[model samples]
Target: MRADPNLYDYWPYRDRPKIVWPGGKKLAFWIAPNIEFYEFDPPKNPSRPGWPKPSPDVVGYSQRDWGNRVGHWRLMELMDRFGLRGSISLSTALIDHHPEIIEACVARDWEFFSHGIYNTRYSYGMDEAQERAIIEDSIRSIQTATGQRIRGYLAPALTHTERTFDLLAEYDFWYTCDLFQDDQPQPLKTKGGRLVSMPYSLEVNDVITYGALAMDPWRYADVLKRHFDQLLEEGERSGTVMCIPLHAYLVSQPHRIRAFEDALAHIAGHAADVWFATAAEIAQVYREQYWDQTVADIEARGLASGGTGFGPAED
Candidate 1:
């Protein structure tokens, strides 16, 4: 389905300059580690009580087990190895079942972005009140568990509505990754003014590489490296921002976690020229510097189109 025309308009080749990093850094990278759990509840039409039987192509029983144990540990190891903290997009239900994970995340100072109450159950068909309750409950649960108010949100399966922004604003979230309007953080004009849209990359995400392509971790690493290299080259001409979405279950597996490590090492090795920051940090910077009234002046004058395409911005 096409995006709502009234919500945004896209015009490529606008005159907005590339977003420069703090202190003239070449590229800014944001890593998002998502922890998800898919519970099973079959529809009444089905002759089953659980989710529709899983296919080999989709997540199966084997993958679920792998994601919970090996996958979770590997992600932790990668964070330790790279000396990087990430936003953990978590299922509220999973957090309830695994409170230790929440504690661990807090100890590591990781940012937590709600992925929803669970993956399989979505918020799409719910009424306004139901959706609002789901969002508020997820925030309250996370805050109670981690002692940190959730500042960002990622819709389950990226399924949401126009009201999503209003709800997020009501909850006082700093940003949401639901929209892919721009690479650098951009202002989202909501009823309450603006909130930052921190774009998440579907192209570089582990789900596409592993779940879709069925490729090995090595291949995933190669794809990541190629993207990073191209963006670094572009950074010379214009600033670039890259967001890499990772699933705790997919990237945390023993074989795949290695690729995650390799990718992080590749980026960290060049830390001098790259700025690695959380989504919150990115949004804060964009609000203070790029999306302020001065920058809005340029947008208003048609110097730059307010919305770019839904692709991640290259470095």
Candidate 2:
């Protein structure tokens, strides 16, 4: 059974806003580049315990060696071509297997957000202790590999338990991007304190748009550009942030990578007042500047009052 949907409402947790960016034209845009690599251990039976596995056809075709290599190179190439700094939602097991990738990430100063140890390991059934151990182990492994302590997390398959926030706070992570709250940054109430929930885009996510939707590069680029343009227009009216989630396995494909590249170039060409930022930077700003302290002084009070009324918060 699914948990009560209202459990995910996050607006009541925001702190009051403050002026910090000096110029009101500051617009923060973040790209989440997720890396999900794992050893393909084919299940012996359909009823094997764990999260549901993809069909043999999907997994078999998806795990092509050339596809993985092409995906990796495409990501590196995009980073170089656009000079883009991104948050890598990485699986610790993958990093452990590919130390060179970790080395290159260190050289490029890319931020690593924990995406658990493997893409197939679901945390939903774990006890609090087991979950905490998994979280801590991921942090330690990623930190050891990259020489940088990870501060953010994205749950595998977006599957998480109620204890996830408290566990993340216990590990001293600054924030988490598991939420689909909005196109802007906001705070999440935790047992320890308010942990910022950095917004992540499911609509523009390449995993779905490219892999699942089967959209061509041009269509994908158009979809991304439309979102960017809408966000820019909204930002001009009300200072809001845009978060775009891209997966290395999907977006790094030769056909799809060009679409992403085109979208980046389009944004850059049209960029006059946009702030392309890392997730860490966006979290820092939200923590330091935009958190709403009281209802009377909140900038986006409508969000808290169920303006969209789309998510569980409305109920």
Candidate 3:
């Protein structure tokens, strides 16, 4: 077994390479709203349990159902108020189930990226063919629904296969949000095509803030501002990416939406220095400006490609 995934090289955070974003911006701030669909009683997988509770877990299922039915509207309105266009991490089935939500996002000219066919479907234990079919369906459905081809992916519920990266590249995807290894864009080692790792954070993600940490809404707001503050400071030296991943089910509760707004307003206040972009846009610019330089630097450092690929260093 490989010690490291060799997905990317061990590029040190200190003074490696400088990246100045377009229009002399220091930070590319993006928002990923995970608008997903969950099944009440999904088929079971032995390796990974789809839910912690039993079949027809109404509590779990209905909470997510509320997201689609009522909560997402509040989230969307709040985002619109702050002029933040969502980069939706979509469950492709939502296009068929709730076309209205897709229509609303389309009207705003927001972005739609794959989050597989359903949140209930996990990539674990899926053969190569099954995984490929998932990817193919996501691309075709989202394209046909929105008239925009999906260029980025965040694997459903973050279940990724061994061949995930390779298949994504083979399918001409520009980026994947599954890797959380860095604050800046990194070139992933794909067999043939260029694929970038976009920063899609879990720390400040609403689900984490509310469920894992049991944080108060006000503290959640503070966490977001603090997260951005440090990134903005570091970004002065070279460009950095700051992503806030959200789940409407958690953040759109009446008590919490205002707090979420407070955090966004804090960021939006710094309008001059931040470039609010989507995952596809960030991937496009990074590939154009820095992908080659990064690949060469990693290879030169013997961290990836040909040499001892990611192991104990020798003097």
CA lDDT scores, all candidates in order? 0.73, 0.69, 0.89
Assess every candidate by TM-score.
Answer: 0.85, 0.83, 0.95
Predicted candidate 2 versus true structure: per-residue lDDT over 150-250, tens digit per residue: 88899876778767887787778877888776766655646565467777778888778876788888998999889888877767555566777876667
- Whole-model lDDT, model 1: 0.73
Show the colliding residue pairs in model 2: 15-291, 15-292, 15-293, 16-291, 16-292, 16-293
Residue 307, model 2: Cα distance from true site in angstroms? 21
Top-down lDDT ranking: 3, 1, 2
Off by over 4 Å in 2: 1-25, 42-68, 292-315
Residue 285 CA displacement from its true place in model 2, Å: 1.3
lDDT of 3 by residue, 1-315 (tens): 556777777898886678888889899999999999998788888777778898778899888999889998988888888888989999999999999999999999999999999998999989999999999999999999999989999999899877888899899999999999999999887775889999999898888889989999999999999999999999899899999999988999888888888899999999888999988999999999899888777778776643222333335
Clashes of 3: 0
Off by over 4 Å in 1: 1-5, 11-14, 42-62, 236-238, 293-298, 303-315
RMSD of every candidate to native, in Å, equals: 5.1, 4.8, 2.3
- In model 3, the clashing pairs are none
lDDT of 3 at 50: 75
